[model samples]
Target: MNFNREDMNIVIVGHVDHGKSTIIGRLLADTNSLPEGKLEQVKERCRRNSKPFEYAFLLDALKDEQEQGITIDAARCFFKTEKRDYIIIDAPGHIEFLKNMVTGASRAEVALLVIDAEEGIKENSKRHGYLLSMLGIKNVVVLINKMDLVNYDEKVFENITKEYTEFLNKIDVEPKCFIPVSGFFGENIVDPSNKMSWYKGQSVLEVLDSFEKEKLPDDKPFRMPVQAVYKFTRDGDNRRIVAGTIETGRVKVGDEVIFYPSGKKSTVKSIEVFNGEARESIGSGYAAGFTLNEQIYIKRGEMAAISGDIKPKVTNRIKVNLFWLGRSPMVKEKEYILKVGTSKVEVKIEEITKVIDASNLNNEVKQQIDRHEVAECILKTDKPIAFDLSHEIAQTSRFVIVDKYEIAGGGIILKELEDEENKAHKENYKWEKSYITLEERAEKFGQKPALICITGKENTRKKAIARALERKLFSDGRRVYFLGINNTLYAEDHNKKEHIKRLSEVSNIMMDSGSILIATASELNRDDIETMEAAVNSKEVIKVWVGENEISEIDEDLFVSKEDTVELAVDKIKSLLQKKNIIFKPF
Candidate 1:
């Protein structure tokens, strides 16, 4: 039994007061991993307080935790068997601390789901089971703790095991085995229990050694998000190197790579290191840098991937399965920052498809995702981002939402949604440089040029609102124009794409002249918006939906109800324009 093998991470999770900490404490004390006199110190403290000593006090070192008698944080402990070393992560069972539990369990390969035999299956028991599967922990073992209270009855253990297995099966989680254990008395943990002769199975220590270590993803598609681009000219050792830690697969010198979201192509020139020997190749889990053959201008947040491998999806919209743990409910019409890999971008909840109750597995159709609720939603980013689907590469598919500078939620990307702007036929045409920069034009006009698309259903008051907005802006001493989509000049043919292209060309001219171009196109889909954005280089396109029911799948910036009068709609659009800085606010 070689104990020098790779270490395995295992998380212990269950409901509050279900003996999670007790199990960890017993495992540590039994393995002789505790420091000298540490156990005596805790026992003396318990005696001073006139309380009996328990095994749970060994890991709950926090004063608050000792007084409250519940784990507030994810505590960690280490122990070793003859086969391999184990890092046991003790996650909290309180519902308020589910976010901390998720953070800890995400780093583990196996999960230990404990259930109170005397309390039967509780709410957190089911919730923890589902989360274990969602976190990609495939190997799970059921620990029926506190069997002493149940008189070590085999029937009590079997009934709880049957109920939990059914729940796990619904979530596609199959437990490896169910072991009845008394962590308080250390039965079925390290030594066999003489009380239960009918049960003949491996101990908890034996099961830990049976689980295999998860293999590193060195054979998958290569993925490395560019962290920084360094150029050190101080010592005359000028090497334009792109540096990042590889998330998966391996890379070698001379390999053709493509930077995502920009589609820039380059070949790896040379592997780089500081104060070390030269290398020709590098694998995952190592921070490395390499120069490129072409001088491509790629900034941070761009994913550097091998060309021949499965290319990452680039889009502004995605469908994800996420859990909300924010102080406020995740609602529509508000923006949040989504961080995935090294890329952070402004994201908004476009639509909430379903909100799931993790404990009962019940789903409801709602517009907002409340705290502690799991939801499947469509999120649209302000710009395009590069990512892989969770099924393809789980490492790069995970992301977190930052609200008010705090990580309020986390999730995995389920599917990539095609954005019309990103799906447009990409060409290698170079833009003709203008003599004056955009800053010069913006300063001269006292406002930034923009393309305002007033879109909604056919019967909605889109054209009326568009004309009213243009009239108000013009009266306010600003250059503005109202163009109808069905203008006879470009509406001659029925080709919608060609018609949109021509309209976009006209709008581009108006925007270039520093005028706010308001175009009314009814039932405009995402593809139409993409075409218009591609034509107007670098200008912001604000889609204002002028109806209650948004039939088209356009990611609109503002929504004005059709019940509002033309004056109110115009005011709403004006306020939005001011907020977006399309027009200067009055001092």
Candidate 2:
């Protein structure tokens, strides 16, 4: 199998009943690309059914599609031109199968957005245009199809051209050319149309032949996300291969490669290929594997990049421009899976900054994102994932959100959030404790070591309640200590966050001695609790709140009124501790 010409993937997209399939059928018929009896077989079936043979019906092989007269899924047709071989992908134009259209368009290098000249621009016409821009397709050619319905009027062509151009321009897209044609009559498709004598431009075939090949990212920084790590030690051959498709640039043998997030470094020992000649290097668009010189601890989710100045950003939080296609609205509370490159992580919508309607580009202020709505939001993943900015490196930046194992949304990273990881909080610091195990100490003390947090608004008697709880627990023969705010923590530490951190650290020290540490804080939200949780270095913090229900983000184990007596609050805390087996029951 030898090929002299390059392969060009061209996708035809538009609204329903706009003659997209008809145009494709016509292109096949005129170019002599169809199989010997493909057209005749379709025509014979139509004749047997006592139906008229239409160009649109030629591509609709399914009985349902034949009856409905619309394309349901993306259909591929292979044909060759003098310059190159083309794979014409006919994408469905209906709104219901937008995902199918996206799948088709994402694979194409060139697009032909078809429109009905008589019907003019419709809702999907604008939506598909917006999607094309978002899908990163730069080479677009608009076809004002069905000119015969409009009596081949040049004015009709001009009007659609003017209207669609304005819409496309708003989204920063400038089409390469707009051609007037009738797919049914084969006007300006394969041959120059005599009906529209006033128009002079390249025909459909000419424009397609003139289309340039998609540029590979060979000159960019080398980045290959590790898709899988294979160890085929079954045949006494021990070669741990890191497999992935090169997203950009090239990777050669002996190139120093660095894995992100974990910051593991290794050198490429060899380029591994199956049943292929020995290759020195593999460039972008090649799914190649590498055998590292050193067996460093590398994972599938990490990206392999050439160690240099150009590198992907390592962050857990990111700001993105995303489109929601899920049946349910994208809310901040729910967790979704975000897949970028080869990395997949559990993510949540941290914040919704803005929402825009794809049809009209209207800005909407909403907390939740509904289906087909585009939103700018901050998404936080459970762990750090490496990626590039959309504008800087598109291949590594674009991602998709999966809800319930289905791809529900797609997004591009706009900015990386660095503040989340900026607070080191003594990364290398470890607590110095007595040789005796904390669990052993707890057993000896007849109580479990726990950090009991009593939180509420200011002047809610939280400190008094904490002190009472400590006294009650101590009287019950359990070693407990009370740590109040506004004493040594907040006053000595100028920063409020630092004060809360110090309080947590001090509470941890008390718990290390198998003592129940009662601490009082004001207005603790989820993030604050997380900070304390991290500082304490344990999941022993039992949350209890006083006063009105002000914090909705966190679920407290118990809520007590500020008017409650300190003794009653202490009794309630004791009962909760007993229920969790944190304290021993009296015999």
Candidate 3:
């Protein structure tokens, strides 16, 4: 679609009741961009609801929102000024409507942060500002709205502006312009206000029109996040096309391009837009399709860009700053659905390095992130996905975490998985040596107690103890199998079996190995523990309880303790081995 000479995409955002919708409505009415009967229809609806005719009602269309007298979703309104055509997105200011704000702001190049002159900077106002920074929106114009409510007082405007400026400075966002206006009174929005003659500044529209679009980074590498794939069969042509809006740089025909993660390379055959193939090259801001010379597997959501200058990395773990909005607390064990651009994958919160106290933005690592809290966390996905740092590339860096089908949090990746191959190799080697040495010793000793399951209330503490025990057992020249719950072998093929059968299988494997299996299970009920005990056979089983819970009424000696150290637990197990008369040479 062709735009006017000064066409720009601008999003209006602020706290709810900050007059975002009214500003848009007044701009449309003043510019004569409203459709013929649209205003009349809005008026009729307002009357039926016993509400005063609000210009905001012209844009907010959701029935629930209109009934509640609040905007719950982002509303898009297109209008034109004498100078430029604008696609103005009116985003909700309510804190719960943050995801809607992100959706709207992600599309716009410029943002108008509307703050109330009467209320100053509220929570949602600061939150919107922080989110804008996270989204990489630098071109911001802070509108100090409700000048009429503040009696168009210059002092009120100045005070609020000063306070907001301080807050913005703390967050590293410097507003390009600060304009005082009244959306309800239609003052200083489309035209200059005579009442604010002391404030010799340009009108809102004038400032927007005068503001220059931030220059594209000259040093930025080519990045195209694949949005969709097109297969055109028009009479004769049967071509496969990959299409997306370029996030940065430029790509030309015959440029060597690479698909991420898969690392498949191909030459760009042609750059095709809606108006057929373009003779020149296509740059950022244009949605275009490219046909590759060879058929390489390029899927939707995969990034395709110039190969040599920049390459996307496949990473399993990432350190990111997350804003948790889920009703449920974000726990480490539970998995969350993550979406970066079009790529979606299930990821677990591996480690919450720090939970930022949103009230003061303090780093609190040990504290659990509750609803509406922002946290710096480490996440590990089930598979390797392409990613970049937010500072390096905003498009690939930002992501949203979803829980129970609702967007819970949004974040930016701070660091990608580093030294992953080396870590993987070390882990593999450890597991291999443990398994090999245990099997060899088992064969020699004729299948002794190979597995030692450590029952506990906390899985993390249990794993830590299990690791320490593995070292101790291996040093004592005994085969030790330290099986973590995350083991893929046990996770797979356990779906079809009954609950009892699954436990039995795990126990049978531990026994067959003839090596002590030190593992932990959380929330182990009496029945489950009994099933596990029976599976391993009471004669060969040694139970270590971490909490005050009776194992079973069976004939097996149990060691129960509330001690929190791994060393103490290891000593108890060592004493038990001595009591059993299992003699072995220490390494």
True-vs-predicted CA distance for residue 464, candidate 1, Å: 41
Candidate 3 local lDDT, residue 205: 85
The alpha-carbon deviation from the true structure for residue 424 of candidate 1, after best TM-score superposition, in angstroms, is: 6.9
Per-residue CA lDDT of model 3 for 201-231, tens digit only, reads: 8888888888676565434788777888777
Each prediction's TM-score versus the true structure: 0.68, 0.70, 0.67
- Alpha carbon lDDT of residue 136, candidate 3? 73
Ranking by lDDT: 1, 2, 3
Q: Which model, 1 or 2, shows the larger TM-score?
A: 2
Give a tens-digit lDDT track for model 1, residues 1-587.
13356778887888888998889889878987665676788999999999999988887653445477754222223677777777765446433233443322246777888899999998778877877766677999999999999899999999998998899999999998999999999999987889877789988888888887888789999999888988767888867889988889899999999988767789998988766665898888677888989766567788989989989998999999987878899999999999887888899999999999878899999999987678999999977899989899887887888889987887789999977554442331244546776678889878888998898877888887888888889888888888887772443578877788778877776777787888888778755776777777534788888777633366577788878899998898889889988888988
Ten residues in a row with the worst lDDT in model 2? 96-105
lDDT of 2 at 67: 71
Candidate 2: Cα lDDT at 295: 76
What would the TM-score be for candidate 1 when compared with the true structure?
Answer: 0.68
**Ten-residue segment with the worst summed lDDT in candidate 1?**
96-105
Between prediction 1 and prediction 2, which has the larger lDDT? 1
Please report the candidate that would top lDDT against the real structure.
Answer: 1
Instruction: Evaluate model 1: give its lDDT.
Output: 0.80
Model 3, runs deviating above 4 Å: 1-4, 40-51, 61-77, 93-106, 215-219, 230-238, 278-280, 419-422, 426-587
| lDDT by candidate, in order shown | 0.80, 0.79, 0.70
Each candidate structure's count of clashing pairs: 1, 0, 8
